[model samples]
Target: MSRSHIRHELSKLESCLRKEIGELANKHQIKLESKQSSLCEIIEVLTQAKLCDEPLFCRLTKLDAAFCQLDIGLYGLCADCENEIEPERLAWDMLEQRCAECAENYEHQHRQELRLNH
Candidate 1:
């Protein structure tokens, strides 16, 4: 509920995500170097690994940005609506800064923008 508490939670989440990303990278490396698999299988494995890693990479970037925002005293506020994000939502995911309604609206608007761009 407090700013310090949120920062502590965010630090823990960042550490956990970093460890998981490292493990994924190591697993991907092992798959790449395994001679037991055929070339096609190796390619497929690497492709799948990339697919998995991309989202984790994105999350890591977001978490880092959130840390920066927190440092600047801007955490726990919705980016779209400038309202405080719910404590329960922040507890569920410290990386989330948007409250539920604003988040949903932002997602809808983002989808529309993507459709228009395409």
Candidate 2:
């Protein structure tokens, strides 16, 4: 696929995920602006850290990280491993970037660790 295609798809998926998260957050009494600010903060931090080649991942992760900041569903997931994150059990989150085993054992373990930490 073209880079634009990949980016477009990623954006679309990210938007959908954000909508879902927003609904859930709102239901739980969290404001959307708070979530947006949290996402912005994470993006700023990630940019400063100079991590990851894929900007789309960084963008999507920022959105998810906001959810994490809200103490909702940012479970520690091994993007390469596809492992069940220890909390909020997002088994249905089919768009997960990693499985448990593969994430823990990927060739770029060092990079993965850094990615997860960010």
Candidate 3:
């Protein structure tokens, strides 16, 4: 898909997620201060406050970062290798940061680290 199209999709998704979060925050009587807040700030506040579940917050965090990356012309590039990310992976999740090779290597290394720590 074109970058514009991808951005549009990401915007829609981010809006939806933000609305959901707003509703939950309202339910909990918490103010978002959205006008003054960045996505990272909002995430930090909500996370520290424990106002939302991990899964929801996690998704929003990814969306926020991905949206920012898009703005910076860095979207769809692997974070580690700086190569273009696979279409299949982006199709699965636009928030994906690592290409398949880097992802597999990261996982392998992480598992090794876990073993070492254990």
Candidate 4:
């Protein structure tokens, strides 16, 4: 997908999240600090209240980070290796911008570290 397409999709995701989160909070009588909260604020509230599970929280976190990187023309670059992220990963999860090799290595490293600690 094109950068424009990814940008548009990210924007749409932000809007969708805002709308759904707002509705959920209203329905539950949750008190958000801001009536017109920011994307970060929404994330914070969602996290604080445990309104969503790990996968959704992870997705939202990735989306938020992607938006931050997009502003500086770094949206689809691998965070670990400074390479273009694989198209397959991008297609599967628009916010997963890590190249396959680096991602695999990173995961392996983390797993090894966990094993050593445990």
Score every model by TM-score.
0.66, 0.37, 0.75, 0.73
Candidate 1 regions exceeding 4 Å error are 30-53, 113-118
Clashing pairs in 3: none
Residue-level lDDT of model 1, residues 1-118, one tens digit each, is: 6778877887777667656655665866643433344324433554566653477666665676687778898888888788899989977877886899999998999899999999
Candidate 2, 1-118: lDDT as tens digits? 3435434554576666566545544564544443465555534543554434544435457445534422443334544443545433233342344554564566578787889999
Worst 10 residues of 4 by lDDT: 51-60
Off by over 4 Å in 2: 34-38, 41-118
List lDDT for all candidates, in order: 0.70, 0.49, 0.84, 0.80
**Number of clashing pairs per prediction, in order:** 0, 10, 0, 0
Ranking by TM-score: 3, 4, 1, 2
Best by lDDT: 3
Model 2 clash pairs?
79-98, 80-103, 81-99, 81-100, 81-103, 82-98, 82-99, 82-100, 83-99, 83-100
Candidate 1, residue 89: Cα displacement in angstroms equals: 1.8
Report the number of the highest-TM-score candidate: 3
lDDT of 1: 0.70
Error of 4 at 1 (Å): 4.1
Task: Tell me the tens digit of each residue's lDDT in model 3 across 65-107.
Answer: 7887888999999999999999999999888988999999999
